[model samples]
Target: MELRQLYYFVKVAKKEHVTQAAEELHVAQSAVSRQIHQLEEELGVKLFVQKGRNLQLTPVGQLFLKRAEAILADLERAVIEIQEFMDPEKGEVRLGFPHSLGISLIPQVVASFRKQHPNVKFRFKQGMFPSLIRDLVKGEIDLAFISPFPREHEQVCGEVLLTEELYAILPPGHELSNRHSIELIELKDETFVLFSEGYSLRPIVYEACQEAGFEPKIGFEGEETDTIRGLVAAGMGVSLLPEMALFYSGTLQPVKVRISAPSVTRTIGLIHRKNEKLPLVAKVFHSFLLRYFLDYNAKREQ
Candidate 1:
């Protein structure tokens, strides 16, 4: 019923031990027990049952825990919103980005933003495409840098910052590596290395190949950009990689061949909840990215 009681119950539920939760909350074990008992009595349900030395949430308790956690998260966001509204320049931005952007795009934007607004802080989380969109809809993140940006989702909306081309990554001694640019159909017969399923890039590559009239023979599947690149470098198979992932130094690098005919590409952009108002800091960073990339594209044109 009380905020303190909810807080105590949630913490204890997660840790599954009153003593540990008390230690974390910097309170005595008895105080935590008293709060949990009061919360259960008010709710008229047995929240937890004892199993050996640890406590486990009952079926009803598991359901209550989800609601309690959501309430806590909402309250935390409300506090952050008010604090950020008071001092937008010094507030924190919770931003998500895919692994491909971490090397270049993300750092570029963050560095430029901080130069003008040094006090503004950033908390970054790197995720795959689906998880990025999932977190955006769930309110876990304020804004996300996503690729092949979602267009028709109901809960979230995205804006395209820039669309970059995807290139054919070939092994060192492949027969067609000497070509300046090759068509998608040229690689149709070649074995391909691709990102594992659930990655957005895999489908792009698959569809591009399909559009070119051949189902690519996937030779290997990898989770990371560098892993696919490494597989290609080892002559395992060729792959289609975004421009960002191709930046690497020293040896052990795959040959990057441009995809010309039926060109492969993906759009990079930011996504946020459609109807909810963003915290002031998130809005500030969001606007900064749009302008920064505007100049970036203009410079690229000239």
Candidate 2:
């Protein structure tokens, strides 16, 4: 009739006596008998025969017993598997991030996390932070490494993992490339290539330009950071890029620039639901990111 009934039937079949089965199972013999009768009624088949204080299985009972064993075994294995998943040390994490962070900084974080936890697997997806954050809020991704700007959005919490100062990217042999630090007002008249709308980094750069007292002169718009970098290297335009993007491009060296007006800075970090609990894999990755950036900071200080 139910799992309990099947369990009782299996116990009775194993012990071959209702009295002994009830003794071993801590139930009254009458209850066991009632459960068996209810099971028989439910299945429309008699599964047991009583002979002189002993119980024997009917032909149908033998067949049903095999099925019962399989069912119980499957149930037990399922419980164990679920428990293993809940254990946290083993499992897969679905992670998402923006292209800038994914290409620039996340690879080192992933490498470090893998060394610390080789059994854990990370599934990485690259998208703009707004879309990635939407997925994170909807339970689509377990963790996200991205730059945060929509800071007051509900159901999302972010920690500042690293502070990447934005710098100017210029074509090789460009006039600006010779400067140690270019000011925001310096690029006022220059064409600026940037990531398309909906990118997280756009506002940071655009706002800096605004604070510098002008709207950005948009020449070409793109989505991916690498493409923007490539365009910048070709002298199509210059972009305010995180230092990480420079490492990834390996083509253009980001020129150090000081924008004293607004002091442009991007906070790269892990994002997740405000109330949700992070899995063990994500927690480990978060810790790894913290340490990765801390070590990076120490090295930079040196």
Candidate 3:
């Protein structure tokens, strides 16, 4: 039976009088009577015993009345749960970001989001861009912050979260360390500390140097951001990194460089699959990140 018909049957059972039930439901007495009759016939059971001007519940009607109340209670609760998800102040959110953000930005994003939505719980994961993209498409991740794409992968949507400047980090008192900028050609003779193969920035870093007419002397490669930075600080060699990376890793005292190459930029971003529907929590976190980083950029630009 339709939910509306069930509702009428329930109200009539409660009032035990067709006229009073209709008054409470704001429906005409005849409409309420007709709806109950339809529900009883649809259920193939006689739900009421009729006397002069009042009704009593049949055995079947007593059982059904209880079930109907429960159904309506569940329906009411479903509506409330949906509204909570839409409210932004209550929902479960899952976020994935690169290790760089895991250290610097995600904590602040979590703390701030929690202050407003104390009830919402969050799950955070850190992975490289390729791995995070796979998780997003596979439905294992709701939202991601990642490095810029190496190639346009299928079925993924992305927005640049922040454009960060790259700096050439070097040991204290190194000859070129005090300079505001350095040309790639000037470093041709120097050994370079590079991130190990498969790190997202490798190709871009190498290619930028090639365009500047030199292939860097790769002396060492590292797996962790801090390890690479420490190698640079220890006077082992110099390296290049996005400014956002530097903020989380104070392993080295870094130097700012006016990188004089066309491909001398870095982007951290929000990513999700194109056809994926974000859980309400993920959407809130995504929007908050966009605003948080935008606010950061505004202040930095000023």
Give the top-scoring candidate (lDDT): 1
TM-score of 2: 0.70
Residue 143, candidate 3: C-alpha displacement in angstroms: 0.4
TM-scores for every predicted model? 0.73, 0.70, 0.67
lDDT of 2 by residue, 1-302 (tens): 68999999999999999999999999999999999999999999999998778889999999999999999999998986566456556667789988877664677777777777777776888888768888898888988877864567678887777677888777777787877776788889999998888887888899999998899999999987778878887779888887777665264544545444457889877777898777766776677777777887888779
What are the per-residue Cα lDDT tens digits for candidate 3 across 99-151? Answer: 76665678877898788779887777777767888888887778887787433
In angstroms, how far off is 296's CA in candidate 2?
3.2
Clashes of 3: 0
Query: Where does model 2 exceed 4 Å of error?
Result: 1-81, 249-262
Per-residue CA lDDT of model 1 for 1-302, tens digit only, reads 79999999999999999999999999999999999999888999999999999999999999999999999999999997678666779788989998888877788889888999999888888889889988888878999998878888888886899988899999998898888999989988889999899888999999999999999999899989989999999999999999888888868888999988897889988889999888887888888888888998899789
Alpha carbon lDDT of each predicted model: 0.90, 0.81, 0.79
List residue ranges in candidate 3 displaced over 4 A. Answer: 1-87, 149-151, 248-256, 261-263
RMSD of each: 9.6, 6.1, 7.9
The weakest ten consecutive residues by lDDT in model 2 span 249-258
Off by over 4 Å in 1: 1-81
Rank the candidate models, highest lDDT first. Answer: 1, 2, 3
